[model samples]
Target: MVFAPGEKPGSESEEAKLQIASKQIVQNAILRAVQQVSRESRQREAGAGDTPRGSFRPGAGELTKKHEKK
Candidate 1:
């Protein structure tokens, strides 16, 4: 859609191609967003499930068998 000063307009086919390219760019962005949201949802579900998932609350904490006396 960018035109230089004193530049002639593009042909119908050129405009059509530009429109198609723009559409593909928008569609790709939408698809990536959808995938990200879905992945986050799965992580949240895993965090809430019985099995430990993320670092927020990873399994039961272990105690060190060796103790140091100050």
Candidate 2:
């Protein structure tokens, strides 16, 4: 639904806000993927297996150093 100039579908300011929100959504998704990849790489360096379905343990991979037995 296109809005005519000076007559926004909802409100002019609201349309601008929506545009900013959309941009942030895309940016957040990219950031999350990058972080996940970095984590996976570190896991590989630690000799952890690539198992996606198993329960996430603290020391499953790179997290080994981070989570020691209590």
Candidate 3:
């Protein structure tokens, strides 16, 4: 629904207040989801530096070594 400039919802009638509140609730939910996604993306990017890429070598005496016959 479109509104005139400087006009507010729920101003016309008592019933319109319910509709206005519902619209506000939906808009707030969408805004929160967008912000959460943006925050997580930034965190992942920042944490990438803690672990180097392609550097996952197993310990010398780990499972692979134990399984080998003497």
Candidate 4:
């Protein structure tokens, strides 16, 4: 089935809102992927294997540090 020819699609304001929302969704996805790659690289450099697939702790990476104490 398709929309009838006489039926109105939507208002111009609604169309503009939809466009803005779609762009925001795409941008959010790209940013998240970049952040994930950055985190994984840091883990590798720190000698930690791939991060486990689970909830990410806020500051678990700090524990892996080797502080020199006198």
The most accurate candidate by lDDT is 3
Regarding TM-score, does 3 or 4 come out ahead? 3
Provide the TM-score for each candidate, comma-separated: 0.52, 0.48, 0.56, 0.48
Local distance difference test, candidate 2: 0.79
Each candidate: RMSD to true structure?
9.0, 9.8, 10.5, 11.6
- Per-candidate count of clashing residue pairs (backbone under 3 Å): 0, 0, 0, 0
lDDT of model 1 at residue 60?
Answer: 44
If both were scored by lDDT, which would come out higher, candidate 2 or candidate 4?
2
Question: Which pairs of residues clash in candidate 2, taking residues 3 or more apart in a chain or in different chains?
Answer: none
lDDT of 3 by residue, 1-70 (tens): 7776766875565457788999999999999999999999999899877768876757834667658777
Worst 10 residues of 1 by lDDT: 54-63
Cα-based lDDT for every prediction:
0.76, 0.79, 0.81, 0.73
Write one digit per residue (lDDT tens) for candidate 2, span 1-70.
8777677566657668799999999999999999999999998877655556576877446646457676
Clashing pairs in 3: none
Which model, 3 or 4, shows the larger lDDT?
3
Question: Which model, 1 or 3, shows the larger TM-score?
Answer: 3
**Clash count, candidate 1:** 0
> How many times do residue backbones clash in model 3?
0
Regions of model 3 farther than 4 Å from truth: 1-11, 57-70
lDDT tens per residue, model 1, 5-54: 66567644666779999999999999999999999999988867865555
